[model samples]
Target chain A: MAEAQNDLKYLPLNDLHVELGGKMVPFAGYSMPVQYPMGVMKEHLHCRAQAGLFDVSHMGQVILRGCAYAELAEALEGIIPQDVVGLAEGRQRYGFFTEAEGGILDDLMFANRGDHIFMVVNAACKAEDLAHMRAMLPGIEVVEITDRALLALQGPQAEAVLAALMPATADMNFMDVAVMDWDGAELWISRSGYTGEDGFEISVPVAVAEAFARALLADARVAPIGLGARDSLRLEGGLCLYGHDIDTSTTPVEAGLAWAIQKVRRSGGAREGGFPGAVHILEQMTNGAPRKRVGLRPEGRAPMREGVELFASAEGGELIGHITSGGFGPTVEAPLAMGYVPAEMAAPGTVVYGELRGKRVAVTVTKLPFTPANFKR
Target chain B: MKYTEDHEWLSLDGDIVTVGITEHAATALGDVVFVELPEVGTMVSKGDEVAVIESVKAASDISAPLDGEIVEVNEAIVDAPSKVNEDPLGEAWFIKIKIDDVGAVNDYMDEDAYNDHIG
Candidate 1:
């Protein structure tokens, strides 16, 4: 049985979501809408086929400044493995805060906003991440943007829908950041999102956020999506959720997020092994981690949820791995999951078994993003 | 039809009993994707997990409310699981059981009581 949600915080769009018939649920200590009248299945497919609006204001937004570009970037690089100093203006890159032993603190995105760097960290890790940043960069100023609401307009038709109102939105490429105006209101728009589909994340003032969200939903192509669809979309896109996939104990190399780590930060590069966990991470880079994250496709419709034990064969076999994130991928129209397994058995096509109750269900190791990513690169 | 604390409903007719999850359970589960039914002739005690219902978001166990032997399982639900979400209290009944003791059925709540319990 689930406990009562008496202390859940409400989003700025909470009233609007309720009026729109969203089923509210407690997520990350917030009263977030998990789905609308269309349900998760339809809402997920809608985002893939057309456009959907998501309220992602729960994420922490911050601006770091009061220092030189190289200094600020170097300060951030001391904690993370990503090459922040090399990030060009108006460009965003995904990075993770790591521990001394190659464990991830949190995964986030930082964009070089020309004068200052703009960052967005996971909602669950916001407070801790802020404290960590302030402690690390004592001289640098960390400003939390609290009076803004973040909305994601995602899908194949996302561009067309936003471009009709703000024509400049269509010109932005993937990972590009810019400031646009809509009806006399300033919008910090970025061409990036968790969903693999081409989309834009718009940051608007809380005062006009309701009006802005309503305007987007009024468009025929845009439907108001909830957290349920958001999770499913990111799952199908092979994106990691903070606590479930990448956590304090999981390393970037083991979680398959090594791509987010730039070569300049690794061994044999200009800036070799300066960040936290660089010794262990670089070692893992050269000599691979014992276990690696991989995708799983169940033989049947049963979804192998988090913590489901995985084995090598139908009969008694050695415990190989455990599912971390899984669900019925509405877009993939099947049960898809991501889990950790021995490096040798992580290859695609390796057969595994999910222990459901007392039965062993067959699952095949497959490449991630069951549906191909449609990012406008 | 009577309901248990776990949200399963049972229909008693003579010594035979039919079991399924309530509408509230189906709604909470969102969309039903698959259902693993217990085999016929299996004897189950009260509170024993009999069936597994897999939804898009989660997988839940349906427990037996009264001691009984599985008489028949709903193959229609196995063919199309969404039927449980569509008509959970009616056509989507999970399994039929031959009740060993009729007195155990009294432990379940009636329709009005079950509705209030869910509320």
Candidate 2:
């Protein structure tokens, strides 16, 4: 165990997390805090009620720079299905790298940062994503940002807590990105987060990362949250976790992420279908995918977690689908799950059964985002 | 009180042995979200999985410690699973089984031994 722990990388705030009573565990090759002394349930509720601070430095941060913004965006359009060229400067959009087949390589958030394109991919898929981008975009510089640590301050009081430190934050709207000065350091701040709440994701220099985190936690409303609550928060928000919810085998259309695909990239539009797997992906968009991701609310309390098979009836039927991500939703105050099912059975009121411990439990197909998002439009 | 390596604590009174998970086990499990206990009068062999405990992170099962018939099951923890984390050794006692051989309790670890095992 000691030898294995040695192989895991530590975050910039590892000591701080340990001092705060965080239960450190191995995740994505990093020793990250899964929960703190307040536990997962309270941490999840705290994020929804007030504000929670998260250390998300393990995620990959990269800068794709070319001769100009247009060239960089055009080159990126060849890899992803999002409207990169049309993205306004100082704005971010949710997108994914697609494979030759119609499956997602990795879901990512990219911003048009005026001079260059900044992208953040999932931690586990960082190496592959970096390699893929470097291989695909020949002239573009796919530089990974290794000198910064990322932190997300999420919830209703997030803006208030952050704006207290930097007044300019109050003026930014959701998906808006800005390089603001804080304590003599340039902070890459974005009014965006995974939790279904108004928040900010700041990329701070590694030197001042801990200080910035401590400053935020000094607020009574801002508590230190860990990955456990982070998972439940995103799950409740209907956001996808890369490997679990959406993977190399799942397409953006089948994962219910069609909204992220702009019309400019879709069929019958200018700059239509230049990305990888454009033919199959466009076909799926024009017609429909065989299966689709949907929200599920299991009857009673037992959560139908990942790998639990779904059936058409309580007694027996061929396995229709399996849970991708699921757990007790603290904010929703019930057990909720997200999984892929046949498109015909993906309607909001459809009833499916998930086999739990050999017995089939009734699960109703519900709408995504078990809780309403409170974004600052 | 006797404890098993599995972290379950058993207290014997006459022929009925009251069972509950140790506080150490509860702490390790984090916050308990749901618990499904066995029904009363169910015959269970030693090491048979009898109860299910679901926490925020994952799920675990409690096994029958001895050959016995479940006499009573705690409904409180079932209604409020958080009680398992709050009072794991008190009100969160899972079941009371009427075992045929009361001497079986002597084979398990005592309080001090269980503490050393966890240590």
Candidate 3:
């Protein structure tokens, strides 16, 4: 057990989390806090009602640079289906790297940072994503950023909290990115987050990470939230957790992430079908994928968590799908889940059954997210 | 009160023994969201999983401590599972079992021994 724990890496704010009575657990090769003294339930509710500070430094932050912005955008567009060339400066968009078979390698958020492109990939897939980018786009310089710690300040009051620290942040809208100066530190700030709340993801130098996090926590409205609450929050937001909700086996269309693919990348547009798996992806776009991701609300209080098989009827029948992510939504105050089902069974009012233990429990196909997003658009 | 290695506590009065999870288990499980109790007339043996406890983080099973027949089950915790986190020792008792031997409770760890075991 000791040897296994020694294999895990510690975060820049490890000491701070321990000091705040955080319960450390291993996640994606890092020993991260799962919850604090406030617990997951309260931490989740706090992020929805006020503001929550999250340490997301374990995710990979990379800067891709080329001879020119257009050249870099074109090279990136070869891998992802999003219209990278059309992405304006200071703007970020959600995207995923696809395999030749239309499966998702990893989902990421990339921004056009004027001179270079800034990309953030999942913690678990960072190493593979970097290798894929380096191997595919040899002309572009893919530099991995290791000297920075990422923090997400999220919720309705996130704007007020961050703007108080850096007043320039007040003007930035959702999906906007900027390099703001804070006490001589270069803070790469983005007005976006995973919790479907109006928020900012700040990339600060590791040297000042703890101090900046302390500054945020000092505010009465902002509390340190752990990965436990983060999971429930994003789950309530109808967002995907890479390995669970999406992976190498699921396509963007089946995952219900078609919005990330702009019209220019689709069939009848200017720069259509240049990415990997574009043939299958565009075909699915024109027609439809057999299965689609949908929100699920279990009728009973018991949570129908991931891997619970879904059926068409309460009695014995063939399994239609299974839950990918699920838990008690603190904001919704009910057990909610997301899963894939046949397109015919994916409607909002459609009733499905989840097999729990040995019994069949009724689950309704509800529209996501369980709670409406509070993003400042 | 006696405790099992699985963090279940048992309190006996005559042949009937009330069973519930210890405070240590409750704290480790975080907030309880839902609970499924065994039927009142169900018979169970030692180590038989009789109840299910669902918390925000994960799901766990409550096993029967000794051979017995469930005489009563707590419906309050089934309705409002938060009681298991708020008052684990008192109101959160899951089931009452009429055991064959009253001396079975003595075989488990006492309060001090259980504290040391948890420590």
Query: How would you encode candidate 3's per-residue C-alpha lDDT over B1-119 as one tens digit per residue?
Result: 99999999999999999999999999999999999999999999999999999999999999999998999999999989999999999999999999998898899999999999999
User: Which of 1 and 2 is ahead in DockQ?
Assistant: 2
Question: What lDDT tens digits, residue by residue, belong to model 2 across residues A1-377?
Answer: 88988899999999999999999999999999999999999999999999999999999999999669999999999999999999999999999999889799999999999889998899999999999999999999999999999999999999999999999999999999999999999999999999989999999999999999999999999999999999999999999999998988999889999899999999998999989988889999999999999999999999889999999999967999999999999988789999999999999999999999999999999998999999999
Task: Provide the RMSD of all predictions against the true structure, rounded to 1 decimal.
Answer: 2.1, 0.8, 0.9
Off by over 4 Å in 2: A1-3
Regions of model 3 farther than 4 Å from truth? none
Q: What is the TM-score of chain A alone in each candidate?
A: 0.98, 0.99, 0.99
Clash counts for all predictions: 0, 0, 0
Which residue ranges in model 1 land beyond 4 Å of their true spot?
Answer: A1-6, B101-107
> What does DockQ give for each predicted structure?
0.67, 0.86, 0.94
Residues forming the 10-long window of minimal summed lDDT in candidate 2 chain B = B27-36
- List fnat, each candidate: 0.62, 0.71, 0.95
Q: What tier of docking accuracy does candidate 1 attain?
A: medium
How do the residues B42-94 of candidate 1 rate in per-residue lDDT, one tens digit apiece? 99998899999988778889988889899999999988888998999899999
lDDT (CA) per prediction: 0.90, 0.95, 0.94
Per-residue lDDT for A249 in model 3? 89
